[model samples]
Structure formats: C-alpha cells, structure tokens
Target: MASRRRLFILLAILALVVGIDTLERPLANPDEGRYSEISREMAASGDWITPRLNGLKYFEKPPLQYWATAVSFSLFGENEYTARFYTAFCGLLTLFATWFTMRRLTNNETALLATGVLLSSPYFMALGVIVTLDMGLTCWLTVALAGFLYAQSDGTSEPTRRRAMGVAWAGMALAVLSKGLIGIVFPAAAIFLHCLLHRDWTLLKRLAWGRGIAIFLAIAAPWFVMVSRANPEFAHFFFVHEHFERFLTTQHRRVEPAWYFVPILFFGVLPWMFTLPSVAAASWLAERERRSFPWRRFALLWAGFIFLFFSASGSKLPAYLLPVFPMLALVIGDWLARTEPRRIALYLLPVVVVIVIGLAIGWGAPERAKSAWTRDLYGTARPFIVAGGLVISLGIAGAAWLLRKGERVVPLAIVVLATLVFVDCVEDGYEMLSPRQSGRDAAAVTRQWVDPSTRIYSVNYYDQTFPFYLKREVTLVNYVDEFALGQASEPRRSLPTVAAFVEDWKRPGSAVAIMQPGLLEEVLKPAGLAMILIHADERRVVVRKP
Candidate 1:
C-alpha cells in the first residue's frame, strides 16, 4: 500500500512538472520553429511520405516526428501545445520505461530512485517539454534497450521473451523512423560490445535474429523505400550527405572541439552529477565481481559508446547526448538506493554549499555581464535563479537532515521535489531570452500587414518560426543554408542574388520581405528600390513596396 501510494505521488509530480505551460511558451527559433512548421505543412498538405519545409522537399531528417506532430494537429487542432504534445508524451513514456527496466535488474527502491533521477533532471525535464525529435528518438531507444534487457533475463518465460524481443525490434524500427541510422546503430553497437566483452556465443543465439530482422524491416524499411521511390535525389541526400558526410566532415558548419560533450554530460545531469564518479566506480566494481552481463554494465556501455560516438563525429548538438541520460539515471539511482544514509548526507553538504555560492553568483551576475542584452536578461532572470537555488539548497538540507535521522525514501522524495522546482525555475527564467530568440511576435505582426496572397520573401535571412505563425510560405531571396537541396529541386522559386531580388521587386505587385536590419542600408538603398518599412525588430526587419 505504501509503495503504491508513493508511486501515485511520483506520477502526479511528473504530470504536473512536465505538462504545465507546455502550450503557453512560444516556439523558439531554428529547432522548435523549424520542426513545428514542418509538421504544420505535413498536416495541412496531407502528404505524410515526403517532408516539405515551405513546400519544398526537406530530406535532412526522417518523417517520424513530422508524422507524430501531424497526427497531433489532426486530433488537437494545430497549436503550440499540440505541436509539442508528442515530445512530452514520449518523455513520460521514457520515465516509466526506465523504472520498469531498472526494477527488472534491481529492486523497487532502486527503480523508484532511477525514475526520479530521470524525471527531475533539469536537462531531461527541459527536453521533455521542448518540441524536438530528440525526445522521441530517446524514448524509442529507451524502449529498445529496456526490451532487450528484459529479453536477455535468464528466468523469464518463453512467451515473455518472445514479446520482449518483438518490442526490441519494433523499437529499432520506430527509432530509425524517428532520427536515422544512429537509432539502430546505437543499440546494435551496445549489444555487440556486450557480447564481445562477455565472449558469449550462446547470447547471440538468444537474439532470435531471424524474426528480429523481419520486424525491423517491416516497420522501418517501407518509409525509406517509398520516399526514395518518390524522390530519386533522396537516396544520396539522406544516406550520403546527411549521415556519412555529417558525421565525417564539418561541412554542415556545426563543428565543435572534440571534448564538447564532456561539459555537456556533466551539466546535463546536474544535482546528481557530482555523485556519478563514486557511484559509477562502485557499480562497475560490483558488475565485474558478478562475472555476468548485468543491466548496470549494459547501461554504462550504452551511455559510454553513444557519448564517444557523437564526440568523435564532426557535427555536434547538446541534445544529441540525450541517449546517455537514461543509463546515467540508472547508475545514479542504483547508487542512491544502496548507499548508506550517513554517506548520502555527507555527499549533499558540499552540494548545498556549491548551490548557495551559485545562487550568490547568479544574483550578482547581471552586473558583470559584458553584453547589455545579457545583463538585462540575467537581471530579469535573477529572481527565478535565486528561487530555484533556494529550493534546491533547502531541499538538499532537508534531505540531508532526514538521511542523518535514518529516514531513507523520504529524503529522495524531498530531493525529487527540489529538482522539479529547480528545473521549473530554469524554464520559467528562460522567457527572458525568448524575445530575441523567438519570431512569433514578429510573425504575428507580419500577418497583420501581409496576407497569404502577398509575395513574401526572406531576404538573405530566415526566421524559421515566422512561416508557421504567418501560415504561409516565404520565398528565399539570395539565401540557402540547409535548404540548398530543396532549392536545387526548384531553382525557379528562389532569387539567387540581391540584384535578382531587386529586379523582381521592381516588377512585383504588393510584396513584403523580411531580412536582417543592416541589409536595408547596405543592399536596398544602394540598389535604389523604393521600400516601406512595415515592421522592425532587433533580429529582423520587414519591408514592403510602396
């Protein structure tokens, strides 16, 4: 009864923390805006096979997130919340999957702790609500890893093993659909490493490879086949350009230092990060002593390999490290559940001191920042940061006190609540950075002056969020970044240079264009084109022909 009650509370907290204000926040630039707009187009066009951004073939990513968001739009009537619903749903699913997988490997307490670690981690919580394919990819990968873990259990029934294997294969297929080849590659590599480490030939026999391959092909193959058939260029663009070149070269312009993910992994698992080294060391020693493939060790390999895999790649994004979080949660959860109360108290004291100092630094940070915008943003965010720090420091203090008092589970519960508050503060404070980052308000103003029939052009700059809010496509004028492939397919739709845009503008009838502020004086004034400034913001400006 007590366990059930605790589970209910945890579920309630997860729902409240993850679901609140999901729709209230405006979609931020580049990622959230770009992805949501693709789904909006997909939902509107009713063409599920080929993903079109601004009505052009966008083969950069697979169609899984597009499909999910399109479905959400169909049912929920197309809003910010609906666009983001799928990602949040996947986040919740991952939390439950992590708990179940850990429970199978360890005890109920360990599972509960691990689930809390995942649910409350600021990075995980932030990604949970953000509209992105990474959350969906992470969820499917988690399911596959969990299912594989269950299928390999020695005492499970034959039917149960079969079902688990089926899940494992299906997850791989969906994961492929979600992102790309890395979905299958990550899990396959982990399993191979595990087998190689154990030198267990019999383990390969249990994978039921014949049925598993069929399942993977059935779900993941059809989309690739259909899309490739529909668009011949897709084969090379997706396989050669997106996957191979992206991993091997810095052509995409997302190059970073080799150790980029080192700090990301550290900060990504905040509040619990300091506990990892000791816990990881102890867990690894325990796994070695067992002399068998343990769940903890498999999770470690999963996290380690994926981290290293992306670290070696030329392209890098912070969210790409998501696959590592669940496994890290497992390691942290297992440690917290098994470690002594006094030791847990000791570990938290330093954490509290660090957080207190961080709070002081954050409160005073605005004054020291070099950029005026940064100073203003930080100044506005100071309250939330202080509040978040207090919540964490106070909660840690309470949890530490409880640990010294010999109450175990309650302390973990306290920290869970603290983490929720902490993450919430961070998210809430993020609004200060939104105005410069989001084009929603600009797009809204654009809608008032420009209509669907108006010729809208993005002049050498694209505000990815604008089209979704404006509910129409914007022509690319002398600009092609990631849209180069799409532009290649339809050269007639784009103006290749400012001179061409100027020529077209002179002959056009009632057209509006958006571009960077400096372009007006540098390009338009010199070209001698008469223009009316419709709207202007710090990042972009909208101009209309008189």
Candidate 2:
C-alpha cells in the first residue's frame, strides 16, 4: 500500500509540474491575483510583520501563505509561478494528503482514485497556480482532515487513536494558520454532522476533542498573538471584518444564490467527473454493510457543510467550495473501485467526449472568433499541440476502456493520469508561445512601465494577474471621479477623484495609463483627453498618455 501511495505521489507531482508557470505573465484574475501580489510585496518589502493590501496596511488573512509565497519568491525571484508556488504546493500536498487520508478510511484502490479526482479537479488546478487563499485553506484543511480520518480509522487502539488525534490537532493548527478559525470549525462541523447522521455519537465521545483543541491553539496562537501585537487593529479586522462581515454582510457584495456551489462542485471534480456517479452507486451497493466508519457518511456531511456553509455567506466565489473536493473524491474513489465496468463506462463516456469536442472547437476557432467564450481557453495551444492532445485523449479513452475491461485499476489510472499531465504542461506552456496577458509575462511587461517618477493608472480596468506578476503595488480603478481621491490609498497613488489624475494627464510628458477597450471614450472623450491604447488583450487594457 505504501509503495502504491509513493507511485501516486510521484504522479501527483507530475500533474503539478504540468501546470507550473514557465513564463511570467501579468496577473489577470481578481481577488486571488491581487491578494497574491500584495502578499508578495509585503514579503519582499521586508515588512513581514504587518500585512498590507495594495500598499496600504491591510490585514485580511493570516501571514502564513504570504510568508510562504514570499519565501518562494525570495528563492525564485517572485514571478507568477513563484508567487503561486505556495498555493500550487499546497494543492500538490493536498493531493498526497488526500490519498493517504482516504487509504486510512478505505481501500488502496479507493485512495488512488480519490487522489486522482482531486488532482485533476478544476478548482484545485486553477487555484494551485494563482495566489489564492482558497488553495491555502484547502491544503491545511486537508492535512487536518487527514489526521481526523486517521483518528477514526485507528479507533481500536487508544494509544494509536490519541496519537492520530495529536496529528489531527497539529494539522488543524496549520489549517487555522492557513485560513482562520474556519479551519477547525469546518472540520468540527463535518465530524458532528457525520456523527449525527450515522447515530455514531459514541465516536465523538471518545475523540477527546478538547485535547485536539489545545493542540490547535498551541500551534496557531503564536502567529495570532504576534500579528495582533504588531498590528494593533489585527484582532478586530481579522475576526470582525474578514470573518463575520465577509460572511453576513454584502458590503463586499459578493453574494450569490444558494445553488452557486452546485456547478462548482460538479465541474471542480473534473477528470474524475465520470467516476462520481459510481460513488453514489457504490454507496447504495454498500448500504447493507454500511460500516460505522465515517467514510461515505462523513463525505456527504462534509460536502453538504461546505456547499451550504459558503452559500449562506454574503460572499461567494467558485473556488470557495474547494474544501468539499476531498470528501467528494473519497466518495468517487470508493465507488470507482467497486463499480461494474459496464455500468461505470456508461457514465464516463460523455464527459470524455465533451472535453474533446470543447478542445477541438477551441483550437480551430479563429483569432477573430469574436466569441467571449473559449477566447482564453487552453485549447488554442501553440505548444506540443498534437502530442499533448493525443496524450490527453488517449488517457481519457484508455481509462474508459480499462474500466470496461474490469482491470485491477492501477494501470488505467496511470494511463489516464499520464495524459492529464501532458495536457496541463502543453496547455500552460502554450501561453508562453502566444502573445497574451496571462500567467506572469504580462506582469513583467507592466513592471517595465513603472518607475518612481511614473504614475500608473488603469483606465476602467483591473487584471488580478497583473498585480501578482508585476510584484509591484497598484490601485484598482473603481470609480475614479474627483471624489474618489479621498478613498485612494495614497494621494499620489490614489486620489479624491478621477479629476486629479485626469488633470495630471493633461500636463504629462510620459505618465502611463492602462485603459480598457471603449472605456475612456465616455469618461475622457468628453474632457478632450487624447489617450493612446498601448497594450490590449482579453485580460487587460494598457494606455499611455503622450
């Protein structure tokens, strides 16, 4: 089993390397992109003590991710790949952690499949490369949850169980450091829901959870104390603003409908999408032998809590539901191992076909396709195009065929995974071949435009990717009227309004402007400001005021 796990670990590392950014592009996405840039800045600034958001003192999340990324950047010189290395590293770790964690609760076949589902999931793949809090949270929670699962698996021996519990608590502490209290809270919720649903309350009674709590506090408290002490406002902002307000109030206005995660949960489990049905089928198949071991029951409860918990929040992003993937993967792994080949193939065929068709259409689409969709997809790769697609398609088809043959399952998984790795590498590598703003190169270009004397402004546009890649401070233009200056972070960097900068542009010799398409027509045209569109892409609008 350990040898099998080592092989899966090797495969997981390959999957991650496939997505690792080789070219530096400007950060284009938001939230994660921007937050990562800020964290990188804080890390590089030698200001390891106080967290800053966009050059201002901002304390939204704990410093663990920032510190990690900064350390990666220090070692790697801080580009998109380096900036995202921490998140991606967490993601990779989560893959290994999930494999071992599932193995504790179930069989080896289940563990292998579960880990595969997680490694190929949409949310996990994307978050792994971007500077996102979700991946960090996912990583820590997975580690903690793995401990939790081990605790349950070792129920026979008190000493073993307690030892597992200690690991669980320490992992929980790391998870909390990754996010906040939610690290422990979410897992606790999963445990409770599992017990209640299964009438396994006796399991909880033996957990000696208080000791676990103490372990969590011990590992997590120092950072909280140091940060709070360093930044006096840390406690209130960390708890009140970031925690409660982010959840209850729409002041951030990120609220979405309750069924929001429904799609994320489905697509986020990609590559393994076909196998999910088998999990449901397997649960039913095992319904008679339903063990007190909280595998399926825990998975169901875990997924439910993550979906509904985030749904109840005042804010939502597609990636917030990443925590639910591990449980879903567990269910998937368990089912795929036990299901009949014919039954399983019936479910997987469509998913494979759709991905291929999507890839084909995306690749053939013209430069002037004019469709907003697939404009930025991985299908239009200029790198190893034929070889990559062949490998990926073969993987999917071969995996399906293996399922049809009712094989021992390891070889098919390896084949399927071999293709997935090639695809990620080829797809991500192709961006380096094209003239587009993504990954980290775009950020490097933006960095050249910035000097101490040059004032930078985005013209009604913001690319989250820009910030992370540039590794420089920038202000996102929200509503840049004259009144907007007061809301700016720095009077020079920000303003009371757009008038302050617009007025400066009139006197500029070489001050730079980043403008979106058709953006300045209404705002600046009326003021007779002639701005030049310098750089343009699906992701960014760069302008220079001559």
Give the top-scoring candidate (lDDT): 1
lDDT of 2 by residue, 1-546 (tens): 677667776776666556664324345455556567766777668988776655666666777888887788778775556766777678778888888887777767787877776665655665666567888888778787777677777345877778777887887788788778788888789888767766777877766678877887888898788877876766876799788988998876677888887767765665566555556656645754665574676667777788898989988887788888877877777776766766766665676676677667656544545655335443455445556555656676676677677763564455547556655655465554344545354545656666767666654555555655555555545544321322343445554356766776777566666655566666776787876665666545666665
How does residue 205 of candidate 1 score in lDDT?
79
| Native-to-model Cα distance after best TM-score fit, residue 495 in candidate 2, in Å | 0.1
What TM-score goes with each of the models?
A: 0.96, 0.82
Full-model lDDT, candidate 2:
0.67
> Model 2, 56: alpha-carbon shift in Å?
1.4
Question: Per the 3 Å backbone cut-off, how many clashing residue pairs does candidate 2 have?
Answer: 30
Question: Per-residue lDDT for 272-370 in model 1, tens only?
Answer: 767878877887777776544577778888999999999999999889999789889989889888888888788777878877876776677889987
| lDDT for 347 (candidate 2) | 68
Task: Give the Cα lDDT of each candidate.
Answer: 0.84, 0.67
**TM-score quality measure for candidate 1:** 0.96
